[model samples]
Target: MRQIWHVGKTVLGMLLRHPITGTSIIPLLPDGRIVLVRRRDNGLWALPGGMVDWGEDIPTTVLRELKEETGLELVQLGRLVGVYSAAERDPRVHSICVVVEAQVQGKMQVVDTLEIIEVKDFLPSELPLEELSHDHGQQLKDYLNGMTTLA
Candidate 1:
């Protein structure tokens, strides 16, 4: 029927018109510790980042997400560190990511409202990242090594 075809076209059009957008902020503590959250959904420890909204800049989304997730305000964000994507890493659609060095301007206060069950600062070695996806953990480790090399 034309009605069914029209509905299908509408759905397809929407899918083609709007792709999902996301951003992440890599907030680091003063002592070189990174801010991470324990997600309630899977109990995984990961960086402070998430999806970007419509009409939002990537960096703005990152900063906003950082503040929302860890209650940390970013004084500045530096050069792009890296990006990650893998089939097993993200259990959903493919994603294009951009990571940058960021400095926290204030103390991190974990917020429970962000669906974060817990928050803590830890050394890259002592990071509680057991449940993290494979690629994410590797990227974090790489970031740690880069930080160390800079010292």
Candidate 2:
């Protein structure tokens, strides 16, 4: 199964015309927990984010994804943690994620059940890194290490 999946991913990557762009937002709560969503397709926990539509700016992309996946509108789009372009980060396509660490205000709810299976808060220390999708675990690690300052 793993080998088949890898082969499929490789084929998909090769067929793509260009790398896709996306945005990820890590929402930090007052008690120090960050919001995460479990992807319905792969069952992997990930930061809230999705693809950037054509002509959409990075901030707009991040805000839209955050609201779509996590049911939270951006109270403040904190800061860009970094851009991740590692070839291995996404399996379906050559992708880039503009990772943002932010303080968001909203009542937690599962909005897009088709895409997101679960939503919850977790401390960076307690996050199940092994089960995190893409390079999200590493992104969170960078955030925890103070790689980006919150605005």
Candidate 3:
């Protein structure tokens, strides 16, 4: 009765009040190339990343997402590139993205076929910046310019 209604309200509030947290990985290879994934939904290139799963820390999320999206293993988790919190950064939901530069190794493959269509490495000079999905263009630019951002 009253207790049940209060509990339901609390749950709903919790769900709506917090933005989902995610990690966007700039997977840097030893050859100085970066890995980017082609998104299935929009056919646009994007940084390799995904939302942080429950019970996972940020570093763990970065590693898991990099492997899942790009088939690359993290050699070292580099600096935080930025923390993007604009409500419209992700079209599917309100999410806060922690972008990191990761030194990674391993064969590049398309592991998540459902979300990604292609996985490819690009030299810094050859990145398709204008066609990147979401806010990834800005993210990559910040990383390339040797700037850490909070936006």
Candidate 4:
């Protein structure tokens, strides 16, 4: 017998239930404030990101999702913050998110309001970690711990 798993609208063989691939960015302003989006679904603040589509590489997904969610096109991509794969990181599904450090060069706007209610910037020490969605607070914690140098 084969095991089965459900992910979003698709079903996968249990053994093939590889964690979904996603990318998120800790978009920083030149002044050192980090960008975050407020999720419309649950009203929790989160880094801008989304699931990686089939046939897309992680870097492409990172850029695309950043643009889609935050309208940031001129960004300087930095080092990988870390890869988060805790089984309970997300409430919706088991997944892996590649967290990257980035610096956005432009005005911040809420482009994908359906998923993001607003965009805001905050100093790392001033982040409302308790209000972040999905394991984003932990991800940000990893960044602040000097896991990677932000650009």
Candidate 5:
């Protein structure tokens, strides 16, 4: 998990340094699963999100990113989970991430745009180790451990 940690720190740094404008989702499924995506950039699974265009609202941004990245329509959105940053999470630059709770209800599909490599729904325990972002992994672990509820 050394690489994962480094990557997490990198992402954190990018967000801090550049103040990136991005949106992400914690898409909860009907059966209480979460929607996760494996991106082509690093082949790791992360919450669905993307950079926002100028003047876009956070909720709209989250909805757009989810559909563009994972082809899911969200039903509800809740509080901001948290913002993360580090020196090594992203290689390009610091990415300012806005993470929020999203209730998703729709047929799932991989966007043909090719940003995402794959999509999956799994119990927190069943998450593929290869696809997890080291930092977000902790959040998932916390939820799985019953330390936090999807608000």
Candidate 6:
């Protein structure tokens, strides 16, 4: 029992010490619009993404998160927009976000109401630039600049 308790503590400690890995998708529609989800937590718009699950690759994580948050299907995984690892990037926890641009197609719907309020697409010039959640504004800026980054 003591050994089990020690193992559990060690695992928990490791989890807390490491930054969680996640993917943020820049979902681009066929008509050249970008998709964003309205976050239920803060009522702000954000990219469609989530933490990478165990035994999952970045591409899989991107696909799953995109579908779960925006009900969109991946047409093609586009470029690597950037990898954001700033400690204060996410207010909730320390997370390393792998941002990817994905060509997607589907009707927009809120698949996870608990996490999302709504899903909508916007033209590049019509994005809620200043109101995006987390480090998403920077992520989009980087994508729009046509620069692949490693920040």
lDDT of each residue in 63-130, candidate 1, tens digit only? 78887888888888866667654424444444555666788867667665647776678776687555
* Model 1: residue 36 alpha-carbon error in angstroms: 0.7
Residue pairs in collision within model 4: 3-14
Worst 10 residues of 3 by lDDT: 5-14
User: After superposition, which runs of candidate 4 have C-alpha atoms over 4 Å from their true positions?
Assistant: 1-16, 148-151
Question: What 10-residue stretch in candidate 4 is worst by lDDT?
Answer: 1-10
Cand. 5 TM to true fold: 0.75
User: Residue 52 error for model 2, in Å?
Assistant: 0.2
lDDT of 1: 0.67
Q: Lowest-lDDT window of 10 residues in candidate 2? A: 142-151
lDDT, candidates in the order shown? 0.67, 0.83, 0.92, 0.82, 0.72, 0.92
Per-residue CA lDDT of model 6 for 16-112, tens digit only, reads 8988899999999999999999999899999999999999999999989999999999999988988999878987667899999999998899999
TM-score of each: 0.75, 0.85, 0.89, 0.85, 0.75, 0.90
Tens-digit lDDT string for candidate 3 (3-57): 7866875686577898889989999999999999999989999998988998999
Candidate 2 vs candidate 5: the lDDT winner is: 2
Alpha carbon deviation, residue 52, candidate 3 (Å): 0.6
**What is candidate 2's lDDT per residue for 1-151, written digit by digit as tens?**
9889889877876788678988888898877789999999899899999999999998888778888888876777777798888767787777887888778878777888889988899977889876789888888888878796321
Winner on lDDT (1 vs 6): 6
Count of clashing residue pairs in every prediction = 2, 0, 0, 1, 21, 0
- Please list the Cα RMSD from the true structure of every candidate, rounded to 1 decimal place: 6.6, 3.5, 6.0, 4.8, 5.7, 5.6
lDDT of 4 by residue, 1-151 (tens): 1233244324432655688878788998889999899999899899999999999998788788888777776467887998888767877677888889987867788888789898889988899987899988888988888775221
The residue-by-residue lDDT of candidate 5 on 34-81, one tens digit each, is 889887877889878877788898888988888887788878886567
